[model samples]
Target: MALIQGQSVDSAVRNALPPRNLGDAERLVSGALGAVVALWAIRRGGLAGGLATLAGAAMIARGTSGYCPVTETLSAKPAERQIARKQGWRSAAAAASSVTIAKPVEDVYRFFRDVANLPRFMRHVESVTVIDETRSHWVVRAPLGRTVEWDATITEDRPNERIGWRSDAGAQVRNIGWIEFRPAPGGRGTEVRAAIAYEPLAGQLGRLVAQLWGEEPGKQAHDDLRRLKQVLETGEVPTPALRRADADAAMPDAA
Candidate 1:
């Protein structure tokens, strides 16, 4: 959302043009790398060193200023590119997850359709409060015991099939997400797919940092789905204590 805005794809393509498309976490990463490279490059004091210095500067600007014009045409997919243009979204990070649950497709869809149910399975989602039929308020846990609040509007809804949503105006974190539920091949249960695209902001960037430290969104999404399955079938969600006890029970016995 922070990327190049107010540009239409049909107008024309420019070689280098964009806005602050990077986030805090991205900037930190790029800045750190650039610093290392420049420090090393400066010692040589020649043409190759100069080129490396330029590379380091580019990386620094990418993270610090959050602007990377090259991304405008990075992976231009006709249809998806058009959609991103129309929506004013230039996201840099995305995640997708899929899971099969032992519940009917309709049942799975219903659970996801109700925003209030998300906190139960999604460990980081503090709560989702309904505002109206298509609008909802969300509070999500962030790093360092922080939290971010946002309002989101449902963009698409197809019974027992799909649902899509995006953050409303003035939201601190700009995000777009979707969920799909389909019948399993063997008629066993529901196959669910979920995806999210978000721009890095002060609040959301914290989560990105955490992602790098082993709690990536894609992995978390799958864990949430597993919890959802437990909720639906066993009416039980695995707790940390329970997992610890189980691990202890499974340990080898001394001879």
Candidate 2:
């Protein structure tokens, strides 16, 4: 009788957990593919790269664990477990990076605080229209020829040190981020560090947390700061369009 009860308990537990769906051969192949894609994505550096990294990580997890939450969710009956379907803020991708600017902390702080100036240096930012002292509307370029727009309001403000914001309701992409300006060592300049958490896509919440916070932040954030440095020190970025505009202005216009 005791042996039968133990067997029954084992069966119940097995039924409760998601099934190990992949065979050994399939798992090996999947893991290999994931490693390759992940390595390539890390080197690529950008939004596309970040997305690929997440995809690779999912594949790796599925291969090694042999348990796929996504597969489980699709096959799950109403009576089955609900944990596979649960998604929380922790699922959001997060990243951070820092750069030193050749400018005073207060000046760097002011530039970032004026959110409208973001488009001047932030590469993917199409525009930022100030709605009020603490609110703004942002339009940004997404992968493919797509654009995304959102309304956000500043959540925290410190005179010349830090600033933070969060997206408003019904945003296409939810965003929570902050920037800090600190004095650099040896009086060199200000050191700026930015950290952000956001749902990159509308519902891609199953991505791995480690991949989300990986090298992406350094690449994207450093690029933004590099452009900002050019703007702050030299007054403009030398992009192709700007170069053409500069060349034409010296020639002629129908004005």
Candidate 3:
């Protein structure tokens, strides 16, 4: 019959198509759940139950094939799908932090304007290579000895006031941020406030995991600013060992 031939052709086409989405663990879980639901629906024995069973079977097929129709419909290309995922994460997990450095606004602004100086205080930054006046490449440490790299372009620059930047597309992690330097009251120093928002390599879930492990961006920013304060004040970052040695040396001899 024509109907039987059409069904055979459909089967052949389905088998020939490559998987469009769904990771391995997702496939396994979905397959197992679909199998259970299909059996349950078939046992119910009704018109609605029959439809449910069919739906469950379709889900199982999708899982077994590692394809997700919904995602496939949304994005035909793998690269676009990955980009969508990064954008989603970037929108979901945004964080900000600020600090006050005991230095003049001009001094602090100049220090930050030179992106190369970031690694001196930022623990995770591996390096920043300046490409031009407006563009630079950055490498930062990631979990498990991995690293993330991106090219960023300066968006806004105001002398001794603020600087803003955003990463270029296709970066390992999309990021946008700004830093503001304001003169402190009573001629004390500069109030240096830095804010950064980024999507981690694995998205929001990865950020959550990092936070649970005490490696969150907010924590890093705070620590980096603290180091920056130490650096600008003393021209060096004092380690705990160094502080302890200095304390011992300063103490008078006891009987």
By lDDT, the better pick of 2 and 3 is 3
Residue-level error in angstroms, candidate 1, position 115: 1.1
**Candidate 3 segments whose C-alpha is farther than 4 A from its true place:** 1-91, 244-255
lDDT tens digits by residue: candidate 1, 1-255 = 423453544334543545566667877999999998899899987999999999999898787777765543243335544545666755334568888898998888898889899898898899899999999999987655778899999999999999999999988777788988999899889999888766544333444565655555567777888888898888779899988998999999989
How many residue pairs clash in each candidate at the backbone level?
1, 0, 0
RMSD of each: 10.9, 13.6, 14.7
Off by over 4 Å in 1: 1-90, 202-208, 213-215, 243-255
- Which scores greater on TM-score, model 2 or model 3? 3
Q: Say which prediction, candidate 1 or candidate 3, comes out ahead on lDDT.
A: 3
Candidate 2 lDDT over residue span 188-209, tens digit each: 9998889876665533432332
Residue 251 shift from truth in candidate 2, angstroms? 18
lDDT of each: 0.78, 0.77, 0.81
Tell me the lDDT of model 3 at 251: 98
Instruction: Find the 10 residues in a row with the least total lDDT in model 2.
Output: 76-85
